[model samples]
Target: MNKIAIVYGSSTGATEAVAEKLQSALGDADLFNAESVNIDDLKPYDFLIFGASTTGIGDLQDDWEMLLPKMEKMDFSGKKVALFSLGDSASFSTSFAGAMYHLYKALKGKVEIVGSVSADGYNFDESDAIVDGHFVGLALDEDNEYNETDKRIAVWVENLKQYLN
Candidate 1:
């Protein structure tokens, strides 16, 4: 079985671009769009990578909002999930990458979620995405910190290798 699956919802293509980059960096993972994915299609994968973008006051990207309800019904027992989020921290400082929180909330106990990052090095004021002292997952602020996206992805992917392998 292909152990890794990347499921993402991107309305403006920015998140899709990152998802694509992640797939390339990881070297072995399948990509699926939230708009077209169903639970059966995801059943074979042991690890899932979710890419969600924050939009309109920290709302999940349109496609993800539609997918969450269905996800609640799927069996995540024993599976692993990671998340990557896109948000403009300068504009939504109060809720930067807040979409990651929603994703984490949905899958918290159901799956062995990995890839939490320290809350330091980011300039945002607050984010529900932070749980205990770290962001729920990889948080990318390409709008203001475009230069760091690649490095962040590389580091996050390196960390995830321990789990995926």
Candidate 2:
């Protein structure tokens, strides 16, 4: 079984809720707050899932900002990484889930990025999170489509399992 680690930076608890749901869905996974986890600690995990809530106009959550530089310096050569993020798609439609894109950029060449979710069901005007016409990871709009979060997470987690092996 792949050793998985879920690390998140949440300001309003929405992202944390999704992280907890993922932990429940993926049995035996470990969870960590981005502020408290050391970058070196991630080296042991076979798979890394990062969750963050986008703030301002496409900026990463505050805690993620501090940890990102450290993450960039770490070697993720044999690991697979997936990302999830919370954003207000209704209000911030243009830059929805931008933080995930930022994180993707930081780790792109270093890790084998996995779980790119389709953008078909999302209602966004534009997003940095989109690459090759798909969201770089699971994109959640808890502010507007809160009711869909659980289902979305369940599906994304299932999809992620395929990439882990």
Give the root-mean-square deviation of each candidate in angstroms: 1.2, 1.0
The sequence of per-residue lDDT tens digits that candidate 1 reaches over residues 6-104 is 999998888989999999999988999999998799999989999899987877888999998898879887688998899999999998999988899
- Top lDDT hit: 2
| Pairs clashing within candidate 1 | none
Model 2 vs. true fold: TM: 0.96
Q: How far off is model 1, as Cα RMSD?
A: 1.2
Report lDDT per candidate. 0.90, 0.91
Off by over 4 Å in 2: none
Write down the TM-score of every candidate.
0.96, 0.96
Q: Which ten residues in a row have the lowest lDDT in candidate 2?
A: 70-79
Flag regions of model 1 displaced more than 4 Å: none
